[model samples]
Target: MNWNRYIKDYQSYLRIERGLSKNTIENYGFDIERLCLFLEVNQIDVSPLKITDETLQQFIYEIAKEVNPRSQARIISGLKSFFNYLIFEDYRNDNPLELIESPKTGRKLPDTLSVEEIDSLIAVIDLSSNEGERNRAMIETLYGCGLRVSELITLKISDLFFEEGFIKITGKGNKERFVPIGKFAQRYIEIYQKEIRSNLVIKKGFEDTLFLNRRGSQLTRAMIFTIIKSLAEKVGLHKNISPHTLRHSFATHLLENGADLRSIQLMLGHESITTTEIYVHLDRSFLKEVMYSFHPRK
Candidate 1:
């Protein structure tokens, strides 16, 4: 059988048995696919069972030229899982990736913005333009609810449970979760919906999508990144900011202000508390401040 068939079966196992999220499963598939492509390009006819440690290491070395250690480590992990699955099913007698070590990586904290910086970025939005309101709403929703760019783009009008102060987010793997929508995000969406979105000649399938381009179609992820980058440039707030940065900032700010980590995890739609624990490292001073301020008779 071709490698792609095994890959398809592996993806299904990830989805059904492992219960991994869509984005994660895709990442897993992506890692394997990269190896498959590399092998094809080199005319190497080695099957998964036939792959040697030397071959895997050579592939890793090639990948290291483009990506950082963290990305390399992640890909290694994904490939290991794939091989382990094959071993489990008796398709392979041994795992080729078992001897490969994941590249060492330090825990890199995410960049976060202060409340003032976030406000400055928002303040520069030109309210006069047609897209201004939509842009504002987009930023607001990003920071307001801490949504991933994918979630923000896929946000639907009917998903708004505003009466319950929540919005249904279709997260990784199409997992649905109800996240609390802050009043600011809610109000901005309301404004955008009434003022701009209401008048657009929306496409049939995308009629329920919250954010749309001027052509009345769903916005692309690149478009969202461009919007954020331009706004960051306009304000001259110097930090490597993306839509995800806004989200990191949102979660960081909440954690700094003493929001419980579990709640933040739920809001961010993280499957693992470990993923959410990164926020704890963002604000060390917050921990000190919390202890000093709240400790009895301090």
Candidate 2:
């Protein structure tokens, strides 16, 4: 019905106008599709244009029992964006969710690994295997550049500017930024390329893709997560970690070493420095140190 048409058109707007990633567009679509399913299953018979906030609140209340507050907040946010888009297209005069507020999930700090822990995780890789070198290189790059898993997978050989010591990253919304690469990461990547990766039969479309599966295709995000998970298990590292943990570690380590928020924001490809501040939490000791070192009164 109108649900399908509106979902399609709104997704197109997100893709073409907003330049959002495929995953983000799919999530938005899922949120709308879920609302439609709720209406259908309950015999509510409402369309996107005619749906009320009261009905949405009811749907949210039902789902809240099944999901956490963070997820509930995200669903509310997605629905709000969809309605806002409909209003922008002149389908409605006002947003249905204008008055609805998302539940506080609190500012959950990202998990980070310390330098020794990161080294231990990477060092446990069985280097004799072909994937071992590749894994080592990938982990080095992940922490070195503070790359999101998406950015890590899609990194290209051409993006390497080793002489300039910078690797170009295509972040969210396909926005490009250059992040510095240290010699430690560069060395491992070069070793992987020269010793391990080059031996594989390159697939047609993925010739320039940096990280690859054993089949020589571009690596998936799931595969990257699996690699990190397997390593964490092997090393007896108890913390629930992922590729993002390495990224958070990168930013946190930089801040601990006296890097400023604006610099970390640029390096992490964040649009706002506030996001960087939230992303890399500082301990009380570090806060005291910052004040002692830089404050005018100190």
TM-score of each: 0.66, 0.67
Please give, for residues 22-88, the per-residue lDDT of candidate 1 as tens digits: 9999999999999998888878788886776546756776787789989988988999999998988
Q: Runs in model 1 with CA error above 4 Å?
A: 1-106, 294-298
Query: Which regions in candidate 2 have their CA more than 4 angstroms from the true location?
Result: 1-106
- Report the Cα lDDT for candidate 1: 0.84
lDDT of 2 by residue, 1-298 (tens): 4689899999999999999999999999998888888888878877788776546756776677688889888988999999999999999976767645677773234568999999998899999999999999999999999998889999999999999999999987589999999999999999999998889998999999999989999998879999999999998989878887998899999999988889998998876554565568667789999999999999
Candidate 2's TM-score reads 0.67
- lDDT of all predictions: 0.84, 0.87
Tell how far residue 30 is off in model 1, in angstroms.
17
Clash counts per candidate, in order, are 1, 0
Deviation of model 2 at 194, angstroms: 0.8
